[model samples]
Target chain A: MISLNLVLFISSLMFFIGVAGVLIRRNLLIILMSIELMLNAANLNLIAFARQSGTVDGQAFALLVMGFAAAEVAVGLALAVALYRRKDTVQADDINLLNG
Target chain B: MNALFTSIGHNLFLVFGLLACAGAAVMILSTSAVHSVLGFLFSMIMVAACFLCLSAEFLGMAQLLVYAGGIVVLFLFVVMLVELTKYKEKSLFTTQIKWSFPLVLIALGIFAYTMKSNLFDAATPVALSLSSGLAEGLSVSAQNAQMVSRGLFAGFLLPLEILSVILLVALVGALVLAKSERVS
Candidate 1:
């Protein structure tokens, strides 16, 4: 009962939005935000399970996720910056010049 | 524990959750970089507060500090640095409309399957005796810190150390990419 049906529904909703974003967004910045959104959804699950299990491990894993998210942002933004500088645009379609 | 009070609190979390879910979708859907960043900010704060409600105080602080204080600002700065105003020519939506419906359908399918299969199967569902557990966990603070330290050092030393290498690689990759390379 600690993990309510409503919370699970919310989790799924956030996750579904993230998936939609990654699928449909043309902007790299938006894609990265979708990834972050997905991570947030997972983090919510972690906290919920943590409370349900009466242990700190789930919370601990969630903290580790926060650290990973920081690293992910650092790397992702740097990629976005590099791509922007070179392509002069951040559109995802612009980078497909290698197609044979 | 009454019905009215429970409904009200549930309504509050629902509002916050809706803010986050809708904001994240808008963040991706918006062409304006500033609006996207703002949307992400809204979602991050809502998630942090949800963590607090889940009784993971430490994780909540981590989410707030690392996400809202650090990454969201970093995102805004990146947005500004790119000077998106300079590029008035590019269209907002992707050219690949053919892929959107199928791709989103697949992703949602996978997400739904995982949510049901993995979570339902793996959820341990331990009964929460919060009052008893909190009393014990609080009384043994010094002892708990020792255990936490040992766990961090022993079990998590690899990730703690490898993160530095990852950062270094990212930094070098950025510098190398920014160099005057040939554009095909």
Candidate 2:
């Protein structure tokens, strides 16, 4: 059998990729997509550990995170749409209305 | 033949891992918003496969239903609502890549160092076997809906209900936020 560290490596690599996208990309939609990638990476880690522990706790929590992600996407898209309506653009730098 | 059969799980794991990462990369690098949404869907399905490999059947299906089906549709709707043609002319990546790449590399290095030790050290020899053993104890074995529901209702009832409330709030908030002002 292959070692579990490989799974961990996959999780971390995906997480860092998500982080890079969030930090380096200028489009808010891609940023949101990157956030989803990060969430999936965390979910993978949970399922892996749940597999190791023989308990369904991590799976349950993963389900919770999925629900939360759905909620977040809904509201985030709403905000994105609102921003587009007002500003006519979704670029991250163009969105400085909240700057104090 | 025996070796191939035995190593199937690991091979499948590697395939899904690569697919997921490639999808993420596509989403990050894609110039168009629609392409990014498609990439996210691809990565999410690969993640579901990984979950199934780990024997979390219910979560895997849940991931497919909620993510691949629901969230991507929402993203597509927004992509349609927004005017993205202007963005087509601009570069996808910004100036931050000069510094963020090194930061991500260092973070990856730290993660690799910390998780160098193996995680499948449980008394359970194989994840599929453990899940199957637990499954056999229950009436329904192949599908793990029962196991997931048991954990959800018996132990996590409050959180589940709270999540329902949060979804309700999100729905209402989306409606309120997206509602166009109409004046007679």
Among these predictions, the greatest lDDT belongs to 2
**lDDT (10s digit) by residue, model 1, range B95-167:** 6757786877786678677667756655545633323423344443224333333434555678767866776
Could you say which candidate leads in TM-score? 2
Predicted complex 1: CAPRI docking category = medium
lDDT of 2 by residue, A80-99 (tens): 98888777888998878789
Q: Please write out the lDDT profile of model 2 over residues B27-141, one tens digit for every residue.
A: 9988778889999999999999998887788888999999999999989988888878877777778888889999999989877766664343534423322245445567544
Cα-based RMSD of candidate 2: 3.2
Task: Please report, as a residue range, the 10-residue window in candidate 2 chain A with the lowest summed lDDT.
Answer: A1-10
The CA lDDT at B168 in model 1 is: 74
Clashing pairs in 2: none
